[model samples]
Every structure is written in C-alpha cells, then in structure tokens.
Target: MQDEKGILIVLSGPAGVGKGTVCNALREKNTGIEYSVSATTREPRAGEKDGVNYFFKTKLEFEKMIEDNRLLEWAKYVNNYYGTPIDPVLDTVNNGKDIILEIEVQGAKKVKERYPEGIFIFLMPPSLSELRTRITERGTETQDLINERMTVAQEELEMMEYYDYVVENDQVEYAVDRIRSIVTAEHCKRERLVEKYKQIVEVE
Candidate 1:
C-alpha cells in the first residue's frame, strides 16, 4: 500500500440521523483517520481555542478568503461564516493521513465535486418516524423546526444513490464497525495499490 497519500472520507447524512455521534465513536475506535477541523467567523465560546477547536477568523478575513478562493466549501449560516480550509485538508490527506469530513448533504456534494476520489458514505436513520423522534429528543429545535428537519431528511435520503455506501445508524457500535470495515476495504482496493506493486515489479 502507498502510505504517502491518504484517503479522503466524506461522511454525511440528513439532520437528526446522528452522523456526528457515529463519527465521534469511529474516531475513538480507530486512530487511523484524522478529523478535519472547520473554520468559522463566529466568535469563540468559552473553552474554545483557535486553530484547535476551530480556526476562528473575523468576518472580513473570511470574506477575503472567499474572494481568493481559499476555502474548499463554505456556507453562511445565520450571518456567521463557516467553511473548510482547503489547504490543511489537502496537505494532511496528501501526506498519508486519512481525513474524515463530517458535513451535511449539501457540503458533501461540493466536496465530491472538488475531490471526486473521496470515499463518500451516507448515514441513514432506520425510519422517518424514528428520525423525527431523534430530532425531538435533542431538544434543540421546536416542533415546527422538527417538522422542517423531517422534510429535509426525506429529501436527503433520496440522494443516497450518489454515495458509495450507506450505513444505518440503528446501533452505534454496529455502525462504527461497519464504517471501519469500509475504510479497511477502501484501503485494500486494487486501484489504490496498483502503482505500488508496479514499482516493486520494475525494481525486481
């Protein structure tokens, strides 16, 4: 296996499907992949450190970055700027450290455009009703917002065909194991190791 260039894993799903939970669990279970940190223009909350928790920037700075095409994927949410820094992502992955991106469906699509070779995995809820319940249990949104999220989730599920794999987030441990297997399988693909073996053949 070529250890110089690593894999880019894009993990995405609709809201309330527990994509974050599964990603966190997977990170703990395996230390092989690095988590991509996002940059934001929002003010840092207590206990948050710059360049560690998030690369906090001023709104002006962020806009300048956008003007320079420095960000890989970015979106303005409720007047705050949030985006993935392009250089760090490419640098880390290209240096042989697998990086995982936990983003929404829309952002995942953008990453796919820029990096089509990435391993895109979609996390799905068991059912819509269960999805609604999960959203409600979070207590993060009102019933009306929950309804909106359910609608979005339904629409997002239809786009699953674009993904390389779909893992149901029914049981946390099971989902983590399934993702680990996917990573292992991806690394074993013939295409990924083809050139490495060719070099060995030529050397022999």
Candidate 2:
C-alpha cells in the first residue's frame, strides 16, 4: 500500500461534449478518484467556487506564475490564462489516490507533454451537429461565442490520435462505466504490480 503510486487520468473533449457531466458521474461512482483542479484568470461562472472548481487568479498573478514556470501546462484560452499547477497533481498521485483532469484540447496537449505516462482520455459527443445543439441549449453565450467554440471543437476532434482512449459521451452512465473499467484494467497491468510480487518472492 505504501509503495503503490497513483494513476493520472486526463479527460478532454470539445465544448458541449458533456465532459464535465461524464467526469462528475465517474467521480460519484468511484470514491477513490481525485479531480485535478485547474487555475484560470477568467471570472468564475455561476456556482463555481474559487478553489474547488478553479483557482481563480488575477492576470498579473497568473502571468507571474507563468514567468516562474510554476504551471505544468498553460495557454491563453479564450483570452484568459488557464493552466494546471504542477504541485497538486504530483502530490495527490504520490499519495496513492488516482487523479483526473478535465481540460480542453490545447491544455490536454500540454498535459501530454508534461506527463507523457499519464492516462489520456478523449470524450467525444454523439456528433458535431448534436454538439452545436448542446452548446446552443446552454443559453449562456452569444451566437458568436458559440460559433467560436464549435470551430475550436471541430479542430479538437481531429487531434484524437494523441489520446489513449476515446469514450463517447452519448450517455452519461455508459461513459462512467467505461472509464471505471479502464481504471480496473490499468490496475491489472503486470508492470504496475511487479514490485510487490518481487518483494514477496525474495521474502519466501
């Protein structure tokens, strides 16, 4: 137990792909998983907390962090700085609790570069048309903003080659089950458990 290292599970998808919903559902089903909270310079959305949802920072503060190379992966997203802090993710995984991150395409790429061994997952919507509908139904953005998101999403879908797995988020429950199964499978990998078996063999 003490020597077991945690797993890093990254979930990324286009806008309106139900990534947040699917991640939340998986967290509810599996209590051992930890969600990686990202830092952002944007104003907090409705019901979004500062530390829990995102570590809200001022532009200057965030830029200073960028200068210091404190972020694991950061980019100018929608005119704001959003990035993952390096400390929390490493600490959690070392503590033996699996960590999951829900990020966009560019951020996902950054995570892949920083943590190449991390488990990368891409969540896809049923279709691009349906993706448009879902974004429209939100009613929080103007048509122009929605269009921009859709454009970015289309580009993101084309970059799925970098991911270890792609889970279609057509149904929340189904997506949750698939992610859960992935964790179970990862645990069964021979390399992950070899250290424990080696110690036992030497003892007897």
Q: Which candidate ranks first by lDDT, i.e. highest?
A: 2
After superposition, candidate 1 runs with Cα above 4 Å error:
1-4, 40-62, 76-82
Write candidate 1's Cα lDDT for 56-81 as tens digits.
99999999998999988887643577
Top TM-score: which candidate number?
Answer: 2
Q: Give per-residue CA lDDT, model 2, range 87-202, as digits (tens).
A: 99999988878999888889889889888878899999999999999999988778998999998888899999999999998889988989988988987888888988888888
Q: RMSD per prediction, one decimal? A: 2.7, 1.4
lDDT scores for all predictions? 0.85, 0.87
lDDT of 1 at 34: 88
